[model samples]
Target: MTTNTLDADLALRLAVEDLYADYVHTIDDDRLEEWPGLFTEDGIYRVTTRENHDNGLPLAMVYCDGRGMMADRISALRTANIYEPHVYCHVLSAVRILGASGGVIRARSNFSVLRTMQEGDTSLFAVGRTFDTLVEEGGRLRFRERLAVLDSRRVDTLLVIPV
Candidate 1:
């Protein structure tokens, strides 16, 4: 490949990696309100089980169709939703940039989240893979769509926080 092409690829990879880091940190730090800003105005977010994903089912445990919806969910989580006070530590790996075209990038990454409650008990909260469609907006990569496919169907508690 040409030097310019290689440079572009490297830059793209770095940008995507940064986005992933920012995403996890935002959630893990309990800065839920900032989470939605990482997406485009019309971005979509969904969390579903692997079985449902494999079966092409449309059901999702958490579904937000736009940035507005995402913000609303956060609002509900902050003001309306009732659940145990917990924090998530997200470990992300295997971030692969599948393809890029038309200023959009397709990527996937593996993630595992450990949850710690206010009582200091910690446990594996969720293990999943994220399929993301990202676009550059205002000079930064933003998620156009993010779908988290959990490996297991069981959730022991109310999933108030974004995975």
Candidate 2:
């Protein structure tokens, strides 16, 4: 690759990694209101089993279309949903840029989230890979689409928070 190409790739990598870091911090810190701002106005967010995603199944454990729907999720969590308050520690790795097409960048990243209850008990909450399509919107990188494909289909407890 030319020097320009290499530099561009490095810049992209850093920007995407920063986005992931910010996203993780938002959810982990329980700043739910800020989560939707990470995405575009008409973004899509979905969490599903790897098998289902691979098979092209439309079934989703948690799915939201548009920032409004995402905001609704936060509202429900804060108001309607009743669950123990917990915090997540996310470990993300293997962030790879798949390609860029039509002003959107495609990427994938592996993530493992550990959930800690208010009682201080911790456990592996979720292991998944996120596939994302990103675009620059209003001078910042925003997720146009984000799909979290969990390795296991069975969730042991209530999934009140996004992974």
Candidate 3:
């Protein structure tokens, strides 16, 4: 690879990493309102099992077709959904930049979410791979699509929050 190509790749990877970090903090800090802003207006988000994703199944744990839908989810979680109030601590690593073309970037990363309850109980909530397509909009990387495929199919309890 050329020097300029290497520099561009590094810059893109760092931007994507920052986006992921922002996403984690937004949710973990209970700043749900900011969640949808991370995505494009017509972005898609889905969480499913690895098996289901690999098999091309339409099933998903949580699916949102647009930023509007994502916003609704946050609203529902805040006002309608009744579950244990908990926080997630996300650990993201192994970020792989698959490719970039026509201003779109494809990437993948592994994530582990640690959930903590009000009573101080903590557990490994989820482990998954995040497959993402990002676009540069207003000089910021915004998610065009994000699919989180969980390694395990069984969830301990209700998944009120998005993974």
Give all candidate RMSDs, comma-separated: 0.7, 1.0, 1.0
Candidate 1 is scored at a TM of 0.98
Indicate the TM-score of model 3: 0.96
Q: Mind giving the per-residue lDDT tens digits that candidate 2 earns over 97-144?
A: 899878799999999999999999999999999999999999889999
Compose the digit string of candidate 3's lDDT tens values, residues 12-62: 888989999898999888888999999999999999998898898989989
Model 2 whole-model lDDT (C-alpha atoms): 0.93
Better of 2 and 3 by lDDT: 2
lDDT of each: 0.96, 0.93, 0.92
Q: Candidate 1, 109: how far from true, in Å? A: 0.2
Cα lDDT for residue 60, model 1? 98
Ranking by TM-score: 1, 2, 3
Better of 1 and 3 by lDDT: 1
Q: Each model's TM-score, in the order given?
A: 0.98, 0.96, 0.96
Worst 10 residues of 2 by lDDT: 152-161
Give candidate 2 misplaced runs (Cα > 4 Å). none
Best by lDDT: 1
